[model samples]
Target: MAVEFMHPDGLLQQSDYAPVAVGTGSRLMLLAGQAGVTPDFKPAAPDLAGQVHAALRNIIIGVRGAGGDVGDLARLTFYIVDWVPEKWDEVLAGIARAQQAEGLPAPTPPITIIGVQALFTPDFVVEIEATAVLD
Candidate 1:
């Protein structure tokens, strides 16, 4: 499997995506947007960080179910409701923990975080979407 990271700069890329991700894989899994909702469809947490962690966990499970691993993740997009400057550090730390749990390297896949007014659910604070290549 070949993994290519586009726009290697540390500063977040402002484009809709980092760069075109090409993979010679027969199976491609497109995971649905995962929120903090749990197995029982209950909000896993009330805070942003907790919700972020839970969402990432759910995403990993989805990837595994599709015969893929975190390493196969090619792109990640995040939608955050009510983003705040004071919470930046906490958010980054939570992301680090999530990547660690997946046994993935630091500065994981190309990511985009957008602040929105609200999500489909009132209790949801964050949602994560991932695209993976299962080669």
Candidate 2:
């Protein structure tokens, strides 16, 4: 892997993800925001947790489609609608489940979560975009 994640001294080292990611791969993949909607254009899951899980899984699918894996991911940006601090645990849990199902280790990519008022569809609670580098 040409991507390295670092948590320098004096930086917060929470297990959720690394705060910094340096990638030196020759190929880069930029994925569009993946929503919770399924292939049939229907909601994959109705609840926030479910949408979060589906969106994460979709990100994995995108990475793999680009001939990359989770470890190749350098960054992730999550856009959430009506996001609430209280639901963070649920979101984390959904991410964990998606990672496990994909046979991926804990993500080390730099992650950013943004709260927004809405999305393309009224049912979409979350959307995620991923950037990956392939060696």
TM-score, every prediction: 0.80, 0.92
lDDT winner among the candidates?
2
User: How many pairs of residues in model 2 come into backbone collision?
Assistant: 0
User: What is candidate 2's lDDT per residue for 13-84, written digit by digit as tens?
Assistant: 798888988889999899999997798878898887788778878888888888887788889898989878
- For candidate 1, the clash count comes to 0
Pairs that clash in candidate 2: none
* Cα deviation of 69, candidate 1, in Å: 0.4
Please, what is the whole-model Cα lDDT of each candidate in the order they appear? 0.75, 0.83
Please provide, for model 1 over 26-71, each residue's C-alpha lDDT reduced to its tens digit, 9 standing for 90 to 100. 6777888899788998898888777877888898899889887777
